[model samples]
Target: MVKLIHTLVDHSDDVNYCAFSSSCLASCSLDKTIRLYSLNNFIELPYSPLKGHTYAVHCCCFSPSGHILASCSTDGTTMLWDTHNGQTLAVLKQPHGSPVRVCRFSPDSTYLVSGAADGSIVLWNVQSLKLYRSGSVKDGSLVACAFSPNGNLFVTGSSCGDLTIWDDKMRCLYNEKAHDLGVTCCDFSSHTVSDGEQGSRYFRMASCGQDNQIKLWLISFVDFLGCELKYECTLNGHTAPVLACAFSYDGQMLVSGSVDKSIIIHDTKTRSILHTLTQHTRYVTTCAFAPDIPLLATGSMDKTVNIWQFDPKQHCTGSLLEDEPKMSVENWSEEEVSVWLCAQGLKDLVGIFKMHNIDGKELLSLTKHSLTNDLKIESLGLRTKVFRKIEELRIKVDSVSLGIPDEFLCPITRELMKEPVIAADGYSYEKEAMENWISKKRRSSPMTNLPLHSLVLIPNRTLKMAINRWLETQQKYNETT
Candidate 1:
């Protein structure tokens, strides 16, 4: 049975997107802001109404660690903010200056990809917020994007009715005409379907569109050189244009919202309707499933977000929180450490770990010297291996601490800008590089390939000051390290 737990009626305009982390829920709206809520009691967080965007906020997503939140807007910029304090971390401007419609973080949270209305896609390195790669589709307002569970591939859907697949390097892997009218939204299932082989795996993806239909696809990552996308089936449960769709954390159920003012839940395995809810009075725009709980959030044009709870037994056989409690490795007990060691193929180390009473805190603090001196490991290879694993764990536990600031590098030289200059194209570049290009009779912007309206270049003193501050901070950090 499905039960409505709470209704959030805070937004004054149409809600565009909604997302859930393990501890918080975020929703963005046409009111030009994003709101945060605590999952404990569905109370609005103090960081609610993040107001950096100049226009309507279209989409928002939480990183894998939930320490960072990304929101894209009609202002042609995607901003990353500290989820805990609502402080702006970085602002990434679209190259074409088109309104960004969607943004998603890779499974590993190493990369952030944003899609613009001009069909442009920019992949940003999350650590430094530098532009990693940029590409454009043939035609369409890029509307939807989702990363595969494995983080090796991502798929984007456009208003031109095309679904295109891309790799980590932003290379086009596959493209297909998915919907006749226009694709509104798409999502990849969280779980992978094994083909009874050690390496072969197939992922199920769902896409809903203006055609009033949802299509299922079987995506194969079996071969990196030649990925495949095969049509599985079509779901026609919604009566009107389906705006949003998402797979549950367990991948056993799929939910979608549509212009029919209703939400539909489907049994993905049986391809049958489990429930149909008509609680919203207007078009339902977005929906999401909590990663750790049996809760579902749906947003609508009625300017409200409804949170629902589903019985775990009715949807799946196992408990929903079975694998979710280990989210905070820092809070793990000594016994949990032993189990983790065995799972990491280091069963031999579990005995030593238990003897030393090594819990999550101890594991995170293990360095090469500690592993050799404290743990009394003489073998160089084994000590290096243990230290490496611990470092990886540290990264997963607190990745936000590793990232710095953004857009401090010149797009032309791909280096830190010494004398920043703003051209007519509205992008900052190294003054020397821009002057050299202008002197060489190049009357176009190096980044945009568009004609330069004038040769006059304006000095960006603000950017120069920001870069200097960052340099000073880095110098101090290096000295301390």
Candidate 2:
């Protein structure tokens, strides 16, 4: 059961796309402006209409943290905005100035990818506001793109009906003719389900095309072995071409909008229609699910956006539960830290940790000097072990608190990249590791598992300098701490 909560008739032209973050809803229009609405009460923000594009805005999405918003336009640029005040942070011009069709942020929000009408896709480093890499499909205009939940991979759909998967480094992993006509939109679900194989997990993806069908796929990745895509099922609920499809936060429900001016919500587990909504009088162009709530937003060519509300428990048992008040590692108490230490097989340190009253924050802040002088740990080996564990914990916590820059790590070694070089596959790698890979006759790319077209390796001076600057920042932070 679904209820039409509101019909926002603000956009003068067709609503091209609509997306939801945790607290905000954004919709871009052919009128060349984007509107922001507070999810709390559906009121238009004070800076509701963000106007900067010289041409029509095609797509818009918010960063994971909802601090930054990205929008692409026929103006041949993807503009980054400070969501707090709607101030333009940066404008990234597309290569060759092609009209940008779609833009999406990686799951981690560290990267933003924009696809253009000329089949070119540019990956941008969000922090530095610089172009990281660029690639083009063999045929058709690139119109749709989505990043996998882990942010390790992304797929782009083109007007040629091809779906191409690429690694984080911009290396093409797989290319397939997904639709007979053209692909309109695609999305990856946030939830993972077991594939019935031990140690193998897969995520579901929904892709709609002009062929009047919505297709489901299972995308699974094996470390360094590349990714595998399997056709799960085909859905033909729409009488006309399906334009947009989105999965619910829990992956229990999938919603789609089509040319027939209808929106259908399907139960992913049962592969059955849950609800059919026909509130819009014209073709529905885009739809999305709210990240934290059971709300759906659909945009239509009738120049209206419909917001729908539903009960998740009615659809699936315990589908979405209110988050319990769980503490992050930094907020863990001394007892919680002791339990974590025991779980990590350091039970011997529990007594010492209890004596020192080390909480999670202090545990991460511990160094070799602190372990020897403060905790009175005599053995250098034990001190080294404790320090190493603390460092590992810090890395994990830092990754969640502040995302670890992926560009600083080598795709092959997963270590901080040193002496970075660009391979023929359009990905950067450590020079020694890449040289060894080539010398060992491993002609395929480690990231893509595709043959290296050329054996050329060019020094990536920019990335090298960026990594050095990041290292210096980290060093200074450590010294200050």
Candidate 3:
């Protein structure tokens, strides 16, 4: 199921976009500050928030190696920041007549691409930190731009739904109408194509727009005539305008978020909706799945970023289970199984069966007598409905789920410190709470009312590790028992 782990609400204005790196997550806002948060500790990094842009930062992207972060803004400029120390690397301001709506880094991190509302696409050289070149269309504003997986080709999508494909040398290779209204988002998959048709399927790109539909474009390589772009298929389900779409690292699943406040995870091979995640209440502005982890990060106009992960045990048997006739119990796709499970409730003994690593079909194959008398299920009702029949054996959550020992509790809030910091008063506390006391409230630490020497909040990594280990142990004990 798509569980909302955290609702980040630091931005004063609308959170325009969210991007992820290996160890950090970056978000830009209309507040005109780009903030970086630590993924490991879930706390805002110190000395963060590169604040040079004059206007609302619209979009941000991290390089392939997670070293550099590039952001664009309404100020008509792009700023490159060092992700390590939160320092501004360079500012490539070309003075385009319109706001730079989108920015992307090449796979190799050698080039940076920016698309502006003025219909211009600028390719900047990363090493030289200068304008490598630029391309423009006659009309319409460019809303999105993406470099091909190979980085040799790039694409620009406009407000008029026009798509222009360009090469590394800034030459237009393909120009055509792609969607109705405007193209809001586009993503490319250059990862090795799955299946035997790898001979011709060199690259594929998925595009979504205000028209409420998604089109997949497949580019095939020819012997001598270069590459050709052909329409592969169109996916339809979203009733409202689709805002953003991203492919997983493996390029096997594509997730799209829409103004309808829902996310649809689709199978890239079958072109079918594997799951529909409806966790966001407002229009989801952007969605990106982690290239390495199973986490999916989504940002909304509601001023929040949610992290979702796919868990295998929670899924109900349906989509992939239908193929259980041909395959054994061990051959299920964990992601697909999770998608089906997120939609339904956990049925009684079914959850136990799943926890015990019992196959879904094997449970369905049992008769009512076998289910009740042998497996100890009183009444399963029917096999089809047993997908959600997982209540009886559900994990017993305690009043305090983490069950952290009293020693780990913060001195002020009484809650376990997610970001524990050792204040100078010889007391440990949540950093934000401690900061509020000493910095904002102009008072000394609660433990020692005497004026403190310093307000520096040194992170307590050892204590945090202890807290995390305790939480993980309790969570695993709950899950298994």
Which pairs clash in model 1? none
Q: What is the lDDT of candidate 3?
A: 0.73
Candidate 2's TM-score reads 0.66
User: TM-score for all predictions?
Assistant: 0.65, 0.66, 0.65
Candidate 2, superposed: residue stretches over 4 Å from native: 197-199, 315-481
The parts of candidate 3 lying over 4 Å away from their true place are 194-198, 221-226, 312-481
Task: Please provide, for model 2 over 275-386, each residue's C-alpha lDDT reduced to its tens digit, 9 standing for 90 to 100.
Answer: 6677799999999999888789999999999999876556443221112114788888888887666543456899999999999889888988889999999988677767
Please, what are the lDDT tens digits per residue for candidate 1 over residues 20-117? 99999999999999999999999999878899999999999999999999999999999999998999999999997899999999999999999999
Model 3 poorest ten-residue lDDT run: 390-399
C-alpha RMSD of candidate 3: 24.2
lDDT value, candidate 2, whole model: 0.86
Whole-model lDDT per candidate: 0.86, 0.86, 0.73
